[model samples]
Target: MKNQTKMWLLIIISIFSSLIIFIAASFIMGDFGNKGYDIGDLKTISNEVLTTIDQQEKGISSILDAAHAEHPAVHFEWIQADGTAIYNTAGTPQNYDFQQLADHFLSIPYNLWTEGETISLVYKTHLQQQPYYLLMKLPSTAMQPGQVYFFLRTTKVLLTLLLPLIIAFMVPYLLAIWFFSRMNRRIHKLNHALTQVNLQKDIIVLQDTSKDEIGQLTQHYNSMVERIQSQVIEIEQFDNKRKQLLSNLSHDLRTPLTMILGYAETIRNGLYKDDRELQSSAKIILQRSRYMDKLLDQLLDITRQNTHALTLQLAPHNISEMLRKILADYLLFLDGQDYIVDVHIEDTDIMIHIDVALMERAIRNIIDNALRYGKEGHYLGIILKEQQNDVWITIKDKGPGIASAEQERIFERFYRVHQGRQGDGLGIGLSIVQEIVDLHQASIHVTSVPYEETLFQIRLPKKEDELN
Candidate 1:
């Protein structure tokens, strides 16, 4: 249930429970108040007073005194018909006329007057045939019949006004204690988890399965922790890759630089035997310089890709013709290299949007990787075909292919399949290939088996209108 609804329900239950307790307490108090005496005892006392008077065994004063002794909570008075007090337990003289008081008592039903703080019952009787008045005054607390009824009526009026007021104040107070206690517990858990996270620098998750507001807060907190952990891991991996890049660059550049320095020194010192040797040394120097320059260019390209600074000039081009041209260029370079170049290009009129320069660079990098690593197999296969709305370019080579474990990391900067192998070129070639393909919004995947066919496939979306 919703939090608001649950709060309201708690209030309602608290009020109901409070009412039940109040009513029960009121009943107990009422019953306790009425415990001492009742109308039956009063009637019995009055009858005994009459019998004593009729027997003439004792005077009216003596009789009243005896009754007073029997029920001390009651006040007894004997008055003549003329309002003269003949016997009185209280010494105070009557301020009002006895006849009026008697008349008031007689006017009430059952000749019993119950009001205010006291209950007065008047009895008319004859002593020696002479009319006298016997007044029995019982305090309201004595639990006389009329007094009980009066107290209950007054209590009803008081409770009617007071009970709702009490319930109204009590319910929210109780609800506040309950709500705060509940919230404090959940907040404490959250705080404790946060403390652990801060101290340990590790993920700390709270176990809260409730679907309340606090539960949702907990879920969001857990999600945030997960994101933080993932970012931390990503940062560590990036740092490692950066260190690897610097190490590889230092080694690769040093070798070419050292060669160029040595060759220049040899020519400068006139250590060469003839013009042919001098020309060979100059040429070697030039080749090494070009290789170092190419490595530096690759590094710049990767940096631009990482910073999202590389822009693509997109235009639709025939993928079949593009693949054939790339293949012809590679074949010219391959010339007499003992490698089988199997080419299959399905002539398709459809074109795909691409950055021609970046795409060719990507394709050339893949073919170069194959030629370098797959030299032992001496076999290279290139295929271009259209399948549905996508153009697939598959470049397969029979070489000691990548391991399943290393395939995922092959595209990472400076990650080489054959580590510590000199002249393998910086391993950023395939990484740059991946970045270019991603810019074109295409996908690339590689599948390989040891010394078997290693296929690199690039899938590019066919032109939208052509697909339609």
Candidate 2:
């Protein structure tokens, strides 16, 4: 639920609960206080007092003694018709004008008379046929009906006025503590998780089951951590690959550089026997220099691709024609290599969007790999065809094919297959091929069987409008 609605609900519940407790306590206390001092008990005592007066054969002295013994908390006074005090249960007898007092008591309203802290009830009884007034005074503090009624009324009024103020002040104060404490705990957990991430350089996911705002914050935090974790893993892998690339480049450059230097030195010092020998040394030096130049170029190309510095210039072109030209160039280069070039180009006008230069590079890398490694098999096959919405190009060679385990790693930078023909080229060609294909939103697959066929297939999505 929304926080505002939840707060309102809490306030309402607290108020009602407080009111219920107040009312229930008032009733319990009232009932407890009125246990033996209720109006009915008072009436019974008054009746007993009159009965003892009537049955007093010993006189007024005996009646007073009996009344005091029966009800110790009550004070009784006996007066004549003229308000002259005849006897008193309290120490000294006072000649109080009881008749005037009785007249004043009768004149006052019943509700107004019951507001006092004491209850004064005047009784008219005949003592030996003479009218006598008995004034019994009961302290309301002893749980008389007047005091209980007054207490209930007054307490109700004060509580009614104060309850809202009490709830207004206490509810927010109490709720502030409770709500903030709960919020603080959640925030503390998030802070702790962040601290752990900072300390360990690792991702920490929090478990938040609530649907509140705090829970949403937790979800966002977890998502951010996941992204950071993924980026961290990618960075570590990139660093390892970079180190590998540097190592491979140094090793590869050293060989060609060493060969070029030795050949150049031999020619420079006049170590050649004749013009033909000198020419051969120069040629060897030139070839090694070209190889080193090509290796450097490849390294730069792969680096550019990896760092997103290379962007594809996509245009619609007939891949079939592109493949034909590429194959023609390769066939010219493989003139006397004693290799069979099996080419099958499907005559379709299907056009696909691609970066011509990058796509050519990717296809050439696969075919070049096949030729370099599959020289012993003396076979190269290239096929281009349209299937459904995609154009598929398959290059197959009958060389010692890659193992299943090595096939997956073959596209990784500088990851060379050590078991087979051991081509002279560094292992970044296929890595560049994969990157180029991915940039075109295309897919590549490789499958090989030793001495049978090693196949590299490229699938490029055809332009939908052109296909239609």
Query: Per-residue lDDT tens digits of candidate 1, residues 42-137?
Result: 788888888888888457677788789888988888878778777788665463485667554544443343445566777788877789878888
Identify the runs in model 1 with alpha carbons over 4 angstroms from their true place. 1-175, 195-200, 347-350, 465-468
Task: State each model's CA lDDT, in order.
Answer: 0.80, 0.78
lDDT of 1 at 194: 70
> For residues 1-468, what per-residue lDDT tens digits would candidate 2 score against the true structure?
855566667777877897799889978986865443656576777777778778863487668767777787677888788878878887666776646575545533343334445556777888788898777766655553444333345666888776887877687668776886688779889988888875246677999988999899999999989988888887788888778667777777887788888988888888889999988888888888888888878878876866887677888888888888899899898999898899988766668888888899899999989988887889999998888888899999999889898989999876778623222666788988988888878899999998889999998888644422
lDDT of 1: 0.80
In angstroms, give how far residue 80 of model 2 lies from its true place: 16
Backbone clashes in model 2, listed as residue pairs: none
Best by TM-score: 1
Cα-based lDDT at residue 128, candidate 1 = 73
